[model samples]
Target chain A: MASYLPTPDLSHLKSADYHNVYEPAEDSFLLLDALELEAPFLNDQLQPRWCLEVGAGSGIVSTFLAGQVLGSRAVDFGTCFVVTDLNPRALPVTQATWARNGLALHRLHCIQTDFIRGWRPAAQGFDVLVFNPPYVVTSPEEVGSQPRGRGGIDGRQVIDQFLPIVPTILSDRGVFYLVLIEQNRPQEIISIMRDQYGLLGSIVAQRKAGIEYLYIVKFSRDTSTT
Target chain B: MRLLTHNMLQCHVKSCNDPALNFPLQFQEVELEQIEAEENEALLLNLVGKIDWPALVQTTSELGITGLPPTKPDVVKNDPALMKRLHEILLETNVAQGKMVCRGCGHSYPIKDGIPNMLLAEHEI
Candidate 1:
């Protein structure tokens, strides 16, 4: 007799039926993991500052910051997260994230934006910038209408576009936090930021998920006058 | 338009008369918007092989979508970190107000109002 294995059940892991892109159960765990890493960098003293989160998937990271990290804000942190995405279908989940967590609506502002074309912010608007972009490094024919993860050919396309204009969009003293894979040519992205875009930073955290390595990075702008 | 579109674009330079030259249409003017979606780890698993990594990175970087995954993850199953990054890349970034230039032919297609004008001249087609 030959040994046989059953096909994995993938539908259960697909997008939730009610919400567009959020999986409440799965993301809740991921959010906790992100907070575990981000908390040290986002010290409690940094509260009451305006923050912008470019990619607020299911509002997990922001909700974590508001609830677990920020604790209760006396002055409300003046933090306003700008959650953006290309798919108009996913907005409701981000809105519901705060609602589910009992966070105030005033603390969040959602935007349907295209990260590729770039973004414009009010002068000196954000104190912190957080992003978790798609860096799958795929081909054009592959990313067909799928939401949430579409990195082009070399996997650095999104990063290249972003580093150049980060200075322009970020507040002068703003801190940047992000996650990327350690396996691929991440040096390519860092080089663009340091050599080309002028952002300076080192990997602040690292974790292994099975065979893949994940890196948490944080950087600050130079104190020189622009 | 997204970098996915950019990868397919090519310039309609003087000597290149191929129809494929009209690819990777350029953007003229566009209205950008961002929306967040739920995390679909399964799709990330499926799409891992579907994407044009270099083009996606190039277009997003050129368009200013930073903070993406460094490369396509090998084992994306049950990995929270990888899935989280997948959520950000797929749902959060937008491509408004720009055009993709063809690397081959150098033709320009303008994106206006969030829609790409992928039309081509008579000769190019």
Candidate 2:
């Protein structure tokens, strides 16, 4: 596969940083690839002003959007990127990742909060929102120890809660990209988003990375309805 | 947190619902810094549509940032000067270290190293 955009430089993150923040893995890159596929539509059509990564860990995904997807693919430098993480340590790590990548800070901001509760966007809403959740299936007990590590019961714990809020968080032209594993039941999630929330949902791309059947699910406003 | 981000933040405590009280989280003991960046005139014009003009005025006044007109200025005018100034305050000014106190719930969210922590306690949630 020919790579159109260069991958973001996350070399600034040290080994110790991974202790608290999640290290970029196959899942992160897959989300980046999915976004890259939509770069044309995003830059040309949507031209999102406000973007966010719900659980930006090492900030690799956000860095990719800021540097490669939004910045280089087009000249939309004004597009603001907001990164939020439940883990406090992830905040600084994500900040450092963007800084090391030479991204301008005027459009990059970080906050610590759970979900979109802390997010307070106006009518424009989040034009592009991405979340690569913890899709490793594990017992409920495991979820407590690792919030971003394993999803309790089919890795749907966080994703389920996050699904309902997508419509509310997204703008009329906004599109959301979410990553999930096979155990996470991607089809069912798509239906729930469409039927329940009035969003048009579908899997953009799915690839098998190692043993995990990674899927990138995209949800956008159902223009047909209105 | 930048002024643009702070403008959107509000008191989301489950019990706090009043718009007047919840919104425009008050900055306290803030360590402000000016981090320069390339100016984007189009961005400034685009942001004007959604930015809370009144809230921005109140915030700037509260933070002792003067010279801003109470109403939203015409960044789209022939003058590039207003756009540059707004680009600085709205995007460049950083809230390095401080706490944002909610006018309604009296909840305080802390800011350290340019990131604001809005995670509430279980009870607050």
Candidate 3:
């Protein structure tokens, strides 16, 4: 009788070390959800010219925007976005995704930046800032360096860092669209923008995901009030 | 670009305080390619914060290229001229051939074609 031997499973070993293993389903869903909100913002002419996507992990949102901007049936005069992420490895992959989708390479620019410190867009401000921040409320260890799902201790560190810069980076009539977990301090985020940043804000979209509630916020800086 | 190079490139480098070992130079042996294309004004303005414009200007000048715009725009709303200049600086200009050396740390990073080799020594690591 021949000896029975089993092959070693090398599946666990991949050449690259990523902060988070790629999950196509979750990623695609996030993109679709965010787009559901953004599409109307663009379609309704409520800041249709340019957009920005913070925490653009694998470039799914960037790729989709490029297609919408450069496709044959582009709706607006022009649409472009700056995709920013902290992971350097994500840059080329983001670029590749756009190319793979036959989107105009010009419609997207990828950047590597740490949002914890803060970010200043190459442009002073954006018409629309779309953010799907990491909001898993957990301890530091649970949310250390993984770029996709880790938010500092209470899941508000990233949001807090971004709050102060809202005035510095958004157009006068711009809106910030974001999704946060139910556990996140949504009232706190809104109050900071309203009281500190001096912008009128509201939660435009919300959906429950298990125990967490995903939300979309829109803010406008009315110069008349200022 | 070498992390060492990137480290040395600081907005405050013109006037250093302490810990200035990594100041001004770095290396990469890479190919230079310039692809002319439309400049996305919105994107360039967004990148203003991420780029070390002055350092980039100096570095590109060292490479005998005068690509970046002399002036930044007050507003980046649909400005064709600004967009053209931004396009040249961000996309057209390439760091394809040379090594980047830190003016402060005396560290060197080699470049192959247009890609930068940012690996560090074992001890440095």
Candidate 4:
């Protein structure tokens, strides 16, 4: 079995914080596993300068990315990790998470904004982007109503809204990692990204988490066509 | 918030997207604090390529904390004094309590407990 990156120390997070923020779950770990699997590529080839994590609830994913993926080589690669979330409670939780792991505050920045809204045209050229959006199938009203695990109808509302902007924000060598459930039609998402946006995508990792099947999809610009 | 974060942030208010006007939100009534952190010289040097030095200098000056040169200095690696100063400005200083006023829209985002509230109201969103 391949050794996985150690999970960030989230011991500081109490039960109270979970009430408002999205707790790290199976899906979150799956994303972390995928990032770890790609660590060699990320650190050696990509050498991402700016990394952004959308909807960084609990901030475990970004924290892991900073501490594990990039922290191992912090001196050589000065990657700035930026995370954004709509929840007011998540900002502080993320800060604490990073601090507990001994990561520098300057290396990680947290902003409370709705799906990259506050970081519009100015927040482009991201070398790496990761999002574990609300992928559970639910009513549209539940998308932004609460903190986490709620997605609108078919669970694609947030995913759909965020997909169009991926090509724009990503740098020429940028790569994006997104988490999805079986019900969300991962194939269709892959096709849409490849055909419409000219970005090629593939299922980098997948696991059966109880009744739900989780998939980690990675998308990058198709240099062949571009 | 650290000056490194401030370097990347810009006013995202609707109709304030212009690059020239949106950058480096002006600090207002800020309560700055310092917390000691492990110093990593290589990391600080790496950040120089991505940081907007001019904006950082101007913003820190506005906050009444002046140490960064008007221009980004060359030879950040060999100069220990310069590296120490950069380390403090980037990692040590934090906005414990205050708000950042957007240069373009004049909207204020509050900072409490060192976290900047970037959430905008429905109209702004």
| Correct interface contacts retained, every candidate | 0.00, 0.72, 0.03, 0.64
Residue B103 displacement (Å), model 3: 8.0
- Candidate ranking under DockQ, highest first, comes to 2, 4, 3, 1
Q: Can you rank all candidates by lDDT, best first?
A: 4, 2, 3, 1
Q: RMSD of each candidate?
A: 17.4, 1.9, 9.9, 2.4
Per-model tally of clashing residue pairs: 81, 0, 31, 0
Candidate 1 vs candidate 4: which has greater DockQ? 4
Q: What tens digits encode model 3's per-residue C-alpha lDDT throughout B1-125?
A: 22212322321222322333343453345455665555544545544434555555666666566745555445644666656665575655555456656565556655443333344433553
TM-score of the second chain, each candidate in turn, equals: 0.64, 0.91, 0.65, 0.92
Q: Which candidate's TM-score is highest? A: 2
User: CA shift at A184, candidate 4, in angstroms?
Assistant: 1.5
What are the clashing pairs of model 2?
Answer: none
Model 4 is docked with a DockQ of 0.52
Candidate with more favorable, higher lDDT: 3 or 4:
4
Please say which candidate is ahead in DockQ: 2 or 3: 2
Q: What digit string (tens of lDDT, one per residue) describes model 3 on residues A118-163?
A: 1223334577776777777777677643545677767887777777
TM accuracy, model 3: 0.65
Q: Which of the CAPRI classes, incorrect, acceptable, medium or high, describes model 3?
A: incorrect
What TM-score does each of the candidates earn? 0.54, 0.94, 0.65, 0.90
lDDT string, candidate 1, A1-226, tens digits: 1112211122333345334553433223433465455565565544435566665556666666665665455124434455565555544566566777666543454545454232212223355777666655678555422355665765556655567667666666677766676633666666666765567766765566565466656666665546
Model 2 segments beyond 4 Å from truth? A121-124, A144-147, B74-79
Top-lDDT structure, candidate number: 4
iRMS, candidate 1, in Å: value is 14.8
